[model samples]
Target: MKKLFILFIFLLVCNLQSYSQIIFENGYFINENNQKINCLIENQDWKNNPTGFNYKLDGNQNILAADIKTIKEFGVNGQSKFVRALVKIDRSTTKIETMSREKNPEFNDEKLFLKVLIEGNATLYLYDDGNLRSFFYKNNDSEIKQLVYKMYLVGNYSIAKNNYFREQLFIDFKCETISQKEYENLAYEKKALEKFFIKYNKCNDPNFVSNETKKKKDLFNLTIRPRLNSTSFSTNNSMSDTFDIKFDSNTNVSLGVETEFIFSFNKNKWSIIVEPTYQYYKTEKTKESSVYLGGEVIGKVDYKSIELPIGLRHYFFLNDGFKIFANASFVFDFSSQSKIKFTRNDGSEANSLDIKSGTGFGIGAGCKLKDKYSLEFRYLTGRNLLSNYVTWKSSFATASLILGYSFF
Candidate 1:
């Protein structure tokens, strides 16, 4: 288990460094010279606005990088766009624990790459640094301006929001079709602001086309998984050494069905998974008794259970066809009518113990191909099936080679 965990960490680090190479898409960048060069830009599906970007020229093998200082604008075809701008931004923390007492925003002038969410009569832009998200806008020939919105502490006990952005919107964007109630209810979020901007643009010109790039919505999948598990079990009586026994390891097959829900954010690189699996083990052994004279002990075990594992998975795309992922799972098993029995050398029964269900944990790493097939190496921690017994304890561990085929 320790070795498996170390390997998972090593693979995770390596995959993070290499994932950036798989997503170069057709895009164009405007340099300081005002020259628009068509090239392939690496799209990280950035969670936050980036200060620099990587690109490769046509027929070139070497990758290049450009920063906000050199690039005036860049766009990944129809997917997304960013423009360099000098604007007044608030750097105040919105966290309740460290909020300021001032109601007004503390603004500073900074140069940034603002993401274009809607580009029309009234354009909406977003600047996010993972912790803070600030919106900016510009109309006609006016200079770009930040929307005023802040959260601050009130009386050191309660929080207050300054919704000055709604007032700013009502004054700047005087539209006959937009109502004051809509402005008052507008949220300082990406989707709501983008929708409002689109509505305003459409009202002015019915033929207006929103340049907003909507993210893909395929976020669910189901898979069939089959595995070969190398399982081992051992048990002992803590009060008596004569009843202790160890079973030989066995290789068994298991089948499972998995449901995965991929998150819409972070480039669809993370997901939650639930898998239900069925497995069984049956074995028998004989050994001489330590305490009984001229007698032998024969032990037999029969166990069957359905296991449910719920986990989180993170993927690193090598390309559209291939990706690597790592996951951790908490497992719960259910079993009935499973037992271990011991008999005397004369074929008479001595004792029988009912086996109970247990809980365990697992860690795995794997790669998927073409969104259909996958292979994984998984290790499960030891579980004590005799946990219901006070004096008897058991250890069951498994290492598995799992194969997966996605149906959708």
Candidate 2:
């Protein structure tokens, strides 16, 4: 089982490297000298605004990288646009950082690639780097400015939020018949910012039309999974006065199916999953007992079960077509038929015991290819199957390797 798991990991690494090739798309970039260069840009489909980009000239193999300071603007055709400019950034400490006796925010000027959110009379831009998020705006090609905000420690160990952005917006863009309630309800998020800018544009010109398109909706996926399973059992029977009895691990192949419902958040990186599976095990062994003088015994066990597991999974994208994921789940197992048979050396009849239902949990990690196929390895340990038997209480454990393909 360990060898198989290692092999799976090796294959996943190879797949990841193979999927990392650059994907060129129709785009253009403005160089430092304010010249628009029509070329093919390598699109990584980044979730966060990248500090640098790669481009090729005239579909050639040679690739070049450019930083924020070297590029004035860039855009993918019908996808997105970004502009590089120097803007004042808020260096305010977070709530946790404010507990260290310093409560003032530091301000500095830096150049960054801000994503163009709404591009009309009042353009709205955004800069996000996974840790800090800041919004910028410009009016009729004027200089860009960052909306001001700060967090500071207050009395009684509390924190106060200073929202200067609200005041600035109301003072700069307030027009005839625009209510104060509209400014008060403005939030510091992408949707709210976009809506406010759109309203401003429409107020200035009744014929103003938006250039933004509707985003794609959330996705639902159903998959068929087939797995290879390995199992081991251990027990000590006090009623039979026997020492530890260890059974050799057994391996089997099984088929199962699962469905995934992906949430429409954070670039579709989160999901909920449920799977139903079937398993069977059969093993037999002969043993010599030291407790019983010159005695011999024969033991056999058989198991047939159905399992249902429900869980949550999160994905980390390595590139455009490959990602790594981790998941955890709780399982309910129903043993349809289980039997344990034993025979002793005194020419005695075989005794049979029936096993009961159980529950367990599993943790696993895997890699996905193109959001359609995946390979996973997991370990499961749980409740005793022989709890109802008088002579023994046995624990069951299993490790499984699963391969899955998404149909929808």
Candidate 3:
């Protein structure tokens, strides 16, 4: 039945040019251009016509053709490879189909399996009579043959083509059946996508170099320097030491300690510092113009004052948790006490007192430690006015050392 069916298809193709033509036998006469002809008896011995002839089939009839010509056909139904052609004299298809008939005693029914491709890899599956199965063998012609062999073969005949094909097919659909151009283009598209992804966000790209990583860094800081105090004063300018009344600042020891606070934001560091101090002073001197043993002498005066220092600080980090800093400040002093007393040769005692505020500038440098601590030394110079020169001018300066901490 299949051969007869195939033959019929062939004849239809042979006589297609003649729309009204009929074929007589698998190897009989064919009419071109629908032309009517004289009667020729069927099965008449020695009755062959004058035209060149061969017989093929058309429906239930036979095709008798006068000439044989060649043609080439491409994939039919988009699956099988066909570099050869079917006769087009009649301009019709001679379709080919394969199926296992249960009615045929030799029916060894096999099914086509499926497969799918992903990221350059293959996934295989087995199908049986429109259903899935476990037993499959390899066959270059079909996927079922391939899967079966892969499931049971011990030889090279079980190549993964079935597996490869199974991967190409999926869900009762045959994608591998598409033309070769489309398949190659699909693979090319995936490759391009991979390259694009790797270029944009891949960590391993050779050209992707940056210092913009989030990481902890050792940073420079700023701090206050400790304060030091000393005093020097002279009174009553004289040409000779023999005649003089002189009193000088004494016990001029400043009390000092450094206090600092630091802060950090992003890559910048800032600091605030203050060094407050106090000093105690006492002195007495007499100037002589002697008018014969008549003399007046004064007792020492006690003086004390508090100094307030405030400054702004800045720093830059170098390395190894080290930093350099500079600072500037203003100083103010408020005297708490001052008193003086004097006695005369005529039996008289006198008293005098003086006190006032002083102002100044402070400058310094220091190093930062551990991102939190720092130490520094700085010089402070400022003006002071007290007792209207009875204490002389309060011009004094000091160097100090300090320690500080940060909270950032």
Q: TM-score of each candidate?
A: 0.85, 0.71, 0.34
Off by over 4 Å in 1: 1-21, 214-217, 302-306, 332-359, 388-392
Where does model 2 exceed 4 Å of error? 1-9, 99-106, 175-178, 206-228, 232-286, 293-408
In the range 334-363, model 3's lDDT, one tens digit per residue, is 778664444445546543435564677766
Off by over 4 Å in 3: 1-227, 234-270, 282-301, 340-351, 368-375, 387-396, 399-408
User: Per-residue CA lDDT of candidate 1, range 301-358, in tens?
Assistant: 9999898999999888877788888888999999878998988777888778899968
| Candidates 2 and 3 compared by lDDT, better number | 2
Judge candidate 3 at residue 178 and give its lDDT. 43
Candidate 2: tens digits of C-alpha lDDT, residues 186-210: 8888888888888888999888887
RMSD (Å) of each candidate, 1 decimal: 3.6, 5.7, 41.4
Model-by-model lDDT, in order?
Answer: 0.86, 0.77, 0.39
- Ten consecutive residues with minimal summed lDDT in candidate 1? 1-10
